[model samples]
Target: MEINIASGLLAALGHESRLAIFRLLVEAGPDGINASGIGEKMGMAPATLSFHLSHLSRVGLIEGKREHRFIHYSANFAVMDELIAFLTRNCCQGIGCLPKSFACNTPEGTSSQHGETC
Candidate 1:
């Protein structure tokens, strides 16, 4: 991903609520979760959740599909992959640096996981 694009994605995730919302969607998998589900899980106000969701969607970090009555939102895995690759493009100066492998996410799981040290 280009620097500008990566920066924009990062900026969108900079907010605490937005990050939480994004992670929830990521763990929700490709099918995603609706705004109400997200609000309930995150305990966020509807208007606040809507604002964060809009920011995430605007940044291409998440995509929403209209179900019968509500929109189901899912993480844009393609864009997420690009962002991760860009962030770690120079991983360990092209070699291993960290001494330990780090789990990518909490028990819910995420898009990427590194089993070995980079």
Candidate 2:
């Protein structure tokens, strides 16, 4: 990913509400969740949810598809993966700095028990 693209994506995710929305969409997987469902699950008002969702969509972090009366939102995994790859492109200067047991802790500080070797 180009720096400008990565920066834009990062800037979009920088907002608290947008980050939460994106995280929820990521958790929902490719099928995604509609605006109403996302609002309900996040205790967000419809307008607020819409704002965040739109911001994510504008930055290519999320994609919204019209499904009849509702719009289902899903994380744009291609862009996400690109962002991840960009961030870690030269990790550890090509050395295997990340151990197999590297921890990706959750918000609660518990280890995810998942790791990727460099």
Among all candidates shown, the one with the greatest lDDT: 1
Error of 1 at 40 (Å): 0.6
What TM-score does prediction 1 earn? 0.83
Report the alpha-carbon TM-score of model 2 versus the true structure.
Answer: 0.83
Model 1 Cα lDDT, one tens digit per residue, 1-118: 7899999999999999999899998898999999999999999999999999999999999999998999999999999999999988888797754333343343434323444323
Which residue pairs clash within candidate 1? none
* Candidate 2 runs further than 4 Å off: 99-118
Candidate 2 lDDT by residue in tens digits, 34-92: 99999999999988888888889988999999999999999999999999999889888
